[model samples]
Target: MVQNPETIQECIEKARQRLYQIANQYPDLWHPEVIRQSMVLDELINEYNQATRLKKTIKI
Candidate 1:
């Protein structure tokens, strides 16, 4: 079965939106900690994607 890129992109966007909503809910307590962790996680995800791209390019 073939998957659509647009559908996958939509799913990723929705997940990001949900994460943002959850992060915004702790307005009274630990807000800074939560935001900092979220930023780290986002950075890690970017790094992982870059590594994956490098691996694919190396294989070609």
Candidate 2:
């Protein structure tokens, strides 16, 4: 139901912030919690990219 790039951007920002928090909380870069949050941030970014790309293609 969410086709808005603005909404996706907000989600990406939130995920990025959360990843930073988790990374700071865990000193080890390889910690499970840190890795999980990093993956989540990556997914949100990828989703945002895909959403934007789709919109561009549709406009063309």
Candidate 3:
């Protein structure tokens, strides 16, 4: 399994690249599992971004 990137931008770019690859290769065969995985990855990226924002707001 591919590991997620540490930075939010890298994580998003990597997920987008994966989705593009799948879309190109499977054209009309959009698998439900792949879409689900993409959604999960997006959720993870969003969570990471939220955590990072919170960390930045902490003065100490």
Clashes of each: 0, 0, 0
Instruction: Between candidates 1 and 2, name the one with more favorable TM-score.
Output: 2
Ranking by lDDT: 2, 3, 1
- Candidate 3 lDDT by residue in tens digits, 1-60: 223235666767777788777767666545875686579678868767676667667746
Candidate 2 lDDT (Cα, whole model)? 0.86
Best of the candidates, lDDT: 2
Across 1-60, the per-residue lDDT of candidate 2 in tens digits comes to 435788989988898898889889998999999999889888888888888898899899
Error of 3 at 44 (Å): 3.3
Top TM-score model: 2
The lowest-lDDT stretch of 10 consecutive residues in candidate 2 is 1-10
Residue pairs with clashing backbones, model 3: none
lDDT (10s digit) by residue, model 1, range 1-60: 223444444555655675677677866436775666566557545655666566678789
Q: How close is candidate 3 to the true structure, as a TM-score?
A: 0.56
How far off is residue 6 in model 3, in Å? 7.0
Instruction: Point out where model 3 deviates above 4 Å.
Output: 1-6
